[model samples]
Target: MATYLITGATGGIGEAICRRLAPLHSLILVARDQAKLDALALTLGGSHHAWATDMGQDGAIDAFTARMESEQVTLDGVVLMPPQPHADDNPMPTPDVWRHLFQVSFIGPLALLKGAVARMNPDPAEGRRAKIVIISGISSAQVLSHYATANVIRTAWVGEAKTLAFALGSRGIHVNTLSLGGTLSPWYRDKLEERAQKNGISFQAQLTIETDNVPLRKYGEPAEVAIVVEGLLSQFSDHMTGLNILHDGGFTRAY
Candidate 1:
């Protein structure tokens, strides 16, 4: 069984991934809330380790790596999904806003990857010895006026992932980004609910309006995301690397 470190282990997508991978692999769950992480580990019913780590905090990444050293947990893969600040809250951007956003969106994840490499690398195997998937939003591709900071910061990750793929491929490590869109996460559902309230319409009506452009006319399920992540981490995608997999419902227009 493989050992994987999943940052942002408390989110809906993160939870689904843990459930999907729990039966087959050993998991290192990381998040900010010790209580929540411990509860999740309990529910997963395995020897998974939970770490209450805030990756955005200074030195947190380094500390986490040190802890892993003590445990001697050699990771076979990593899933990066550190919680980002809600840019919608600060519609009017400031220098501090941009700096904080960049640090969280870009720098923190990069540090995570750097730490993950030491745990995953130097395998004698001919094929991939490790896989890393960055869980970014479709804002990396499409524009979201509400998430002003995200549109720019997340975009940088795509380029970074590509470069790392080429640099790390020879070491039997694969890196990719999974960009999601219109998923029924609690955050998205709340946004739809708010719109429905403002428009004096039913939630379904608002949802229909929001998803009109989607060919599937539906939001991808959390379980579906788990399945896709499973594919990315498994040997099924051994030949794939350095690519961004768009999980949007066929809405992105750019070629």
Candidate 2:
């Protein structure tokens, strides 16, 4: 069975991915909450290890990679799900906020991916080329003035992943980013609830407006996104790389 590392493993979409792949893949769950990770590991009923570390902290990614190295864990794939940026109406947040978001979302994932690439590409005989799936927001391509950090850094990450895809191809590693939008997860539920309360509109009303904008006319489920992640991690996508896939229910029309 292939082994995969999933960062932000306790989040809504992360949890769904774990559930979807638990039967097939060996997972290394990384999250900020030890209790939640432990609970998930138990629920998954597999030989999985849970690592609790704050990605926002300096050297945290390095420490996790080192631990995996010391334990002689070879990963076949990695799914990076950074902390979701809270929607801030500000077009530009304070410099400190931007820095914090960049560190937590972009820099930390870059460090983890760098470390994993070294370990995952040591030998061609071990398995298929290492697969990397970066779960980023739709703001990576679409303009979201409110989510400044996500709009900027996540977009940068798409370019970064494309570069890595080319650089790592000869080493048998593939990299791709998933630009997701309007998924029906806990994170969005809370954000929508807050917006509804603030606007004095019903939650369903707000949801309708958002969903109506999409060609699908509905919000995507976490499981729907998980299926795409599974494909990226599997041999089904061996020929695909350097792709910034839009999982936005036809919300983004850019060609």
Candidate 3:
């Protein structure tokens, strides 16, 4: 079985991905919450291991590399699923928050990939080639004023993945970004609740507006997004790289 390294494995979409792949592969879960990771590990059974560390912290990547070495872990794939809809109540967004988002969304994933590729054996006799899938938001391409940091940083990360794809293609590592539209996950519900409370609107009313706003006439489920992610991580996509595959339900009208 292939071994997978997944960051942000406790988050909404991240959790979905874990549930989908846990039974099929050996999983190394990475997240900031030890308690949550431990709980997930227990629930997923013994084939999964949890590593609690803040991927955004300075030198975090190096520390993770050391841990992998100690564990003798070799990864066949990596999934980057950082926080989405990063928002703050600050009247003006601080530089720290901006930098934090960029670090988590872009730098952290690249660091993990750097470590994974360096450790993975290139011989096809070892197993299938390595793959890296980045879970990004539709806002990365769309203009969402409230989610400025995600918009800017995710876009940059997508570009970085494409560049890395070309450079790493010869090394048997495929890199791609999975851009998602609005999906009905815990994170999405939390944002809806926040919007409702702030606007003095009912949660149902807010949800109605959001669903109606989408061309698909409904919000996507986390499982739906997971399906797309699974496809990207599968062997069928071995020949593909440097692509931004969007799962927006046709919400993005721009060509």
- Listed in order, each prediction's TM-score against the native is 0.94, 0.92, 0.89
Among these predictions, the greatest TM-score belongs to: 1
Model 1 lDDT per residue over 122-149, tens place:
4637554689998988888878878776
Which of 1 and 3 is the better model by lDDT? 1
Model 3 ranges off by over 4 Å: 88-97, 122-127, 194-205
Q: After superposition, how far is residue 131 of candidate 2 from its true place, in Å?
A: 0.2
| Tens digit per residue, CA lDDT, model 2, 100-199 | 8788877877887777776784354665678999998889888976776668878888999999899988777888999988888897899889999998
In model 1, the clashing pairs are none
lDDT at position 134, candidate 1: 88
Question: lDDT, candidate 2, residue 234?
Answer: 84
Error of 2 at 206 (Å): 3.6
Identify the superior model by lDDT, candidate 2 or candidate 3.
Answer: 2
Per-candidate Cα RMSD to the true structure, in Å, reads 1.8, 2.0, 2.6
Off by over 4 Å in 2: 122-127, 194-205
Worst 10 residues of 3 by lDDT: 83-92
